[model samples]
Target: MNANEVLLDAFGRIHEAVAATLQGIDGDSLSRRPAGTGNSIAWLIWHLSRVEDAQVASAGGLDQVWTSQGFAGRFDLPLSQRDTGYGHSSSQVDAVQARPELLLDYYDAVHRQTVEYLQTLGDDDFDRVVDTRWDPPVTLGVRLVSTVADCLQHVGQAAYAKGLGRKPD
Candidate 1:
């Protein structure tokens, strides 16, 4: 498989894990930050989506969909504010799950945009090195893998917090 295909598979798996983990969680459960933590399921999803959006935007040298997609206004926060700490109120959690379909739609849009950006890249684009706010701003391929890893890790956290099952340590 090609680089884009590999990235797509990684992204798809992470999305699936997030969806499955959040499927039956109610507002209370979603808002609950595991003791000593400050991130709820809702916040995690929002943060993850924003990260993906920004990563794609950076890769494509274009603005991300945070505002264009109406996410900032809907969430009453700036796209630049990426604090994923817990401390979510019940209302916030309720709002997130209220329109589950919309969340899924937003995620799908982000994924499509990312794939499109990947398509625009040549072989060298994937291998080109760059600096990012991330610990090690590496090649585009490394960034894609890192993004997927971040998403999957948080999804597992959300699942474990809900007592669904112990996410792999």
Candidate 2:
């Protein structure tokens, strides 16, 4: 398989994990934090989707699905449109609550945009530098890989938190 195919496969795995983690979870369970300071399953999925949407869309020179697709309105989240859950305080995390379907819809929308963007890239496109802040700079391929890695980590976290039950009041 070519590089694009390989990359797509990696992203596909992340999507599968996300779906499995979210399956059968009710809104209450999704909003529950395993520990007082920990993130909830809902927050994990929402953050992952936002990160992927923002990072991938920026790399592709496209508007983020979050705003472009009206998810911000649908979610009506307390945070600003630019919020991607980075360094979110516990209060901010607690502000994120949604039904499982809405959470999955956002994730699926972001994933669709990600896959569509990836499909447009030629082999050489992957070599294009997308970030210069890093010491050696980062390529489009590397950036996409990083996105996948971050999403996978969050998916795993959600899965773990899903099993931990709600934090005691």
Candidate 3:
């Protein structure tokens, strides 16, 4: 009924959706760009995880799970260590090839990290500013909410891409 509990529920949904979306999907299908130009399902999920990892880590003043947990090295794409898939080009999207389990494992690590971070916060903690780059500055609460929205949106896109039911190559 409290803020943390509510956040836990929302984040729990993300975990479930992620597991469902990636289930049984292989790497080629994951990386397939719809019509050969759109964001691949792989890229969407990866970006979603990256955004959550980056924002949550910043809000918590902790290290990103991507680097700290060796995901950057494991993924091993020829991208910057700080790459979050934001504004990545088509070729950049193509560079993010990953197996389903690898993506799921990375997402699971980031999700667990996010859960741990959320568990320690009180309602007042959400009011703390986490980013000051924006016009109004970003608070922990806004950052978390934005992350939830962005995550769900990307996951939904992934699901829809899957539903397009293009024959797996």
Candidate 4:
């Protein structure tokens, strides 16, 4: 398979996991914090989606779905427009409250935008650097792969939290 196809499949897995984990979850379950301290299912999914949205948008030189597509207003969280849940505190995590439908809607929107941007890239595009802040710089391909890994991790945590039901309070 080609680079683009690999990325598509990777992102598809994230969406599948999210859908499976949130299939029958109610609002209370979604916002419940694991062990009463960890990230909630809602926060995990929302943060991952936000990160993906920002990363893909930056790579494509496009507007983030969170702001351009109206997700920021829809989410209505008490965080900055550019906040992606990085370094978020417990209060910030609790601020993100949503039902499964809203979470899915936002994630699906960002995913569609990401897929469209990725489909426009060719093999050669992967070699193009997208960031210079790192010591060796970052390539479009590396950034995308990093984003996939991060999203999978967060989604996995959400799935575990959903299944654990050990201390979601």
Candidate 5:
């Protein structure tokens, strides 16, 4: 497979893995911080989704999807707030909580949008450097690969947290 096809195939499995993790999470478990060590499942999901929104929007020379929605007003500082990396506000979390289906929907939207955008590119676009809003100078393809890596890593974390309940075996 070529680079784009390889990325699409790998991301397809990552999508299934992420969906398995999200579906296994009970509502209460979504807010648990796991001994106060790091972000909860909800926070992690928000972060991952937002990362995709931000990165792809940057590539397209548009604003991120989350910011346009005024998500900052949903602040859930201190306890559920994220400090180390991107996270959602309290309202954003509530929004996500209100619609469990939106979790998968958002993930699917970002993934599909990214793949479609990449499909429009030629081999030249793969090497074309773009100054990313979130990262330093890197080609669009490189940035996308990084985003896929991020998604895969977080899916692993969520799977481990889910114990024996993870699916798609």
Candidate 6:
């Protein structure tokens, strides 16, 4: 498979895992924090979506789907339009309460944008430097991989939190 195809497949898995992890979860459960620490499932999902939206938009030189698509308004989050849940405090995490559907909708929107952006990139585009702050700088390929890694981590956290919220059968 080509690079684009590989990225599409990896991103597709993330989308599928998101839906599976959130399936049948109620709003209260989605927002529940395990042992009242760390992030809730809702926060994790939202943060993942936000990070993807922000980074993909930057890589594509396009507006973030969050603000452009009115997701910021739809969420009405206490945080600013620029917030991506980075270094969010416990109280900030607790503030991100939403139903599974909303979380999924936002994620779906961001994922769509990411796919569209990826479709526009040539293999050479991935080698373009997108960040210079790192010691070796960072390429589009590295940025995309990092975004995927972060999303996977958060999704796994969400899955674990979902399991914790479940009552013993």
- How many pairs collide in each candidate, listed in order? 3, 0, 0, 0, 4, 0
Residue 145 error, candidate 5, Å: 1.2
lDDT (C-alpha, whole model) for all candidates: 0.67, 0.90, 0.91, 0.93, 0.64, 0.90
lDDT of 6 by residue, 1-169 (tens): 7777789888888899899988899988888899889699999999999998999899789899899999999999999999999989888999998889989999999989889888887899999999999979999999999999999999999999999888899
lDDT (Cα, tens digit) per residue for candidate 4, span 22-133: 8989888898898899999999999999999999999889999899989899888899999999999889999999889989999999999988998998999999999999
Cα lDDT tens digits, model 3, 62-129, are 99999999999999989998989989998999988888898999999999999998899999998888
Candidates ranked by TM-score: 6, 4, 3, 2, 1, 5
True-structure RMSD for candidate 3: 2.0
For candidate 1, write residues 48-131 as lDDT tens digits. Answer: 777788877776676677667776666665323443334556444444442444555667677778877777766667877655
Q: Please give each candidate's TM-score.
A: 0.75, 0.94, 0.95, 0.96, 0.72, 0.97
- Evaluated at residue 49, the lDDT of candidate 5 is 71
Preferred candidate (TM-score higher): 2 or 3:
3
Best by lDDT: 4
Error of 6 at 125 (Å): 1.0
Selected candidate, larger lDDT, 2 vs 3: 3
Give residue 10's error in model 2 in angstroms. 1.1
Name the regions of candidate 5 deviating beyond 4 angstroms.
67-99, 132-136, 164-169
Measured with C-alpha atoms, the lDDT of residue 24 in candidate 2 is 85
Clashing pairs in 6: none
> Which model, 1 or 6, shows the larger TM-score?
6
Candidate 3 Cα lDDT to native: 0.91
